[model samples]
Target: MKPHRYQGSALLLALCCSAGLFLTSPVVAEESLEQRVTRMEKLLESQGLVDLYLRLEALQQEVQMLRGEVEQHGFDMKGIKQRQRDLYLDIDRRLGQLENGRPAVSPGSPAKLPESTAPTAPREQGNPATANPGTEEKAYREAFDLLKEGRYEPARNRFTDFVVRYPNSGYADNAQYWIGEINYVTRAFEQAIVEFQKVLDNYSSSQKQADALLKIGYCHYELKNFAKAREALQAVITRFPKTTPAGLAEKRLQQLKNQGQ
Candidate 1:
């Protein structure tokens, strides 16, 4: 038998072709799978960026709202502090009037108030014929005692009598002033204005002129006469600059302005 050489060569060629086909098929399938996975990864990255952007926008809006709330609270706190200061000033003024005697003011200058624990009697003043110093002092002390005891009616009567009996006495101006204070304390605003006015009319040399004017302003304020109150308070500040009454009038004026008066 002659060797079948052609048959062997043909069979070898078929085997090589089959092996090449097998190797190429697996490479193509792997490349296709990798392209699909890359596409999916790109899509997921784009979606993640969008979600992050949305979250950032929501956080910014919330911060803006919080900032607005903080500003509103600051404004409210300022108003509350202003109201507290006004209230404190009013309370302090009232307590000073009740707990201490009125300071002795000089005709042309601010005078220092006495620090004496006990209320002292007024010194003698004016001519002997017009004012009996001994009797007038005694009567004034009696009325003042009644006032200190809070016996308002009896003190009013006694002071009324003292003013009549000792018109030119040193204590007469104080008695008149006290009468106004009594009316003011009793809420007789109309009468208080009238009585306080008398201090100006009758006692040109009185040390209580500034205080009287200040009280007149307060009376007008209590009566809701804002214009009149402003006028009287301004008068105190202008006429008695650097005095205690002037300072008090200024505080009251600020309070009125705050109230839109």
Candidate 2:
């Protein structure tokens, strides 16, 4: 009887110990799972912050690139507008001269001459088909035509030839002026300055004087010689106050001021 009681007590103690282990094991597992989930949440929150910062940096860089493009486009538009204005003014001035029947300036021509005795003889104004093939007028017309057709290289060559061959012709100043125009249109600002300066030096009394001066200013501006540009533009304003070139200079001066240049 004592042996059986001892065996039964041992079995009861084993059952109590197993029941306690089973109940406490579930509580410990639940606590461990909750801690894993909390840690995962913290790691994800940190990763999200890093992603947000990277995205902000990318957006800032994009905004800066867009600003640069906008500024470049604005500058290009200004140049286009300026070119258009120059072309229109030049054409208008030329047409006005033709309509007024004004004689071209020549080295040997008198300051005042009767219209009938003008150097542009009837043959010079004759039909192009029958006109003298080698005449200075014809050469000038050919060069001018090439320029109008946008054949810049050929035009430059022909104009250069005309200037060299007809230095005493009535169209000498005009030829020199057109050479500078070609350089200006081609964006050869430095060379344009030299060519335009020749017009001012060689043809001081030419009607193109103001135009040449204005172009010098434009060349300097394009070359970023701001002080020289300002000086030339100011000279235009002071010397040819009411002329078209002066007006253009004023507009350019205002632009420089607006740009803080």
Candidate 3:
């Protein structure tokens, strides 16, 4: 009888411990869904999409690891957080694109200019097609030299006329890029972004895209649109990767995040 009584007591103790663990485990695991959602919202609002994506990925890993073991509150909390994260990312991506300025739309084969005929004439506006390709290029080069000399109006016209007349000339890439350069130097950001994008979309192979991307961001910065600026900078990092533009973009991104702007 004594032996039987001892065994029963031991069984009761084990049962109590199991029950205690089952009940308290969930309470410890739970977190309010509202609180988690609020944190995610704040992160999305405060951080750009890149930072947001990084945080969300971290949060998801946490959720996956704890899913089966946590309380109902915890379970629902994870799902809630994940859903909000997805929604936030989607919204951010779309917004980033809108503000991303123009990326290349479709690539076109860059046109090439014919060699110069000793560079005699500047503009034969009436006989554009018959104008010496080489002479036209040399003239454009001279206009660029004028720009470097701080001659904005003439340089601007030189670039404009080049594009207009030699619409199919290989120098078209260079001509378009120079248009952006002139506008950018003049602090005409709104106009400059459009012009730079024309270069990007039309001349994907142009060595100038890196500089163009950087300037696009700079234009946004000058316009006091920090978010858009960050996106443009990030694109420089993405598209150019490990270049001077990419390095500059990374520096600016860090600065923007630190300022919480």
Candidate 4:
């Protein structure tokens, strides 16, 4: 009876131990599976962070390239604006020249002649000097009017008629001067020189002497006679020191010196 009792107690203890081991093994397996799943989740988050960093770097590079292109375009726009301003200034200068009717001369050239305010009618009398005072003025005024109107040929003819019809008239020198002016303005430099010389030769007392000399110098310059141009310009400065033409001649001389002429 004592042996049987000991055997039964040993069997019961063995069965209890097996049941405890079974339950604890399932709990350990569940904990291991949870740890593995947590590790996988951490690895996936790290990979996503690396991909986002690479995309950000690429976007920054594209922004830098776009900024460089914008700067280049801005530089090109500045150049285009400068060219447009230069073009506008050039057009304005050309239009001003056209409206003036006189060719654009060099920087130190003579100024344009004054416009003549005179009538446009022929004299009915034969001799201009011996004729009535009003008739003489009318004849001179009519000839001058033609010159003011840019009728060069008719002006030349009328002046020639006046000089012939009234040799001793006070306005004869003025008429001759206009003839030279007509030639000078028309670019007939040689003819202008001849006509202007007549003013110095025949009308020494006339006030147009300085003006004629100045034109002579200008004509010589156009003809490329530098020596004669210098001589004539120098003569103007010496002969008419206080005159406006003298100042013009001085300016021209300075220009020549600057040019090494």
Comparison by TM-score, 2 against 3, better one: 2
Which residue pairs come into collision in candidate 1? none
TM-score of 2: 0.68
What order do candidates take by TM-score, descending? 2, 1, 4, 3
Candidate 4 yields a Cα-based lDDT of 0.73
How many clashing pairs in candidate 1? 0
If the candidates were sorted by their lDDT against the true structure, best first, what order would they fall in? Answer: 2, 1, 4, 3
Question: How well does candidate 1 score on lDDT at residue 84?
Answer: 55
Q: Highest TM-score, which number?
A: 2
lDDT of 1: 0.78
Best by lDDT: 2
Residues 27-109, model 2: lDDT tens digits: 88898999999999999999999999999999999999999999999999998897778765775576466435534445444
RMSD of 3: 24.3
For candidate 4, the per-residue lDDT at 70 reads 96
Q: What are the clash counts of all predictions, listed in order? A: 0, 0, 4, 0
Write candidate 1's Cα lDDT for 1-261 as tens digits.
876999887888789777785556778889889999999999999999999999999999999999999999999999767655654464356436534654544444433333422223343456453444455556776887787677889999999998887676666777888899888777798998999999889887777788889989989988999999999999999999998889989998999999999
Please write out the lDDT profile of model 3 over residues 1-261, one tens digit for every residue: 367987998998788788886446665556556578889998888778778899999999999767655776787889668645643453354335323422222224222432421222344466756356456556666765676576878988988888876765555666676688678766788999999998778666665688678878878977889989998999999999987668867887887788797
TM-score of 4: 0.51
lDDT by residue (tens digit), candidate 4, 1-261: 367977887888788677785556778889999999999999999999999999999999999999999999988889657645643453344334333532333444432322221211233556546455455556876886786676889989999898887666666777887788778767798999999999889877766788789879878977878789899999999999988779878876786677688
lDDT of 2: 0.78
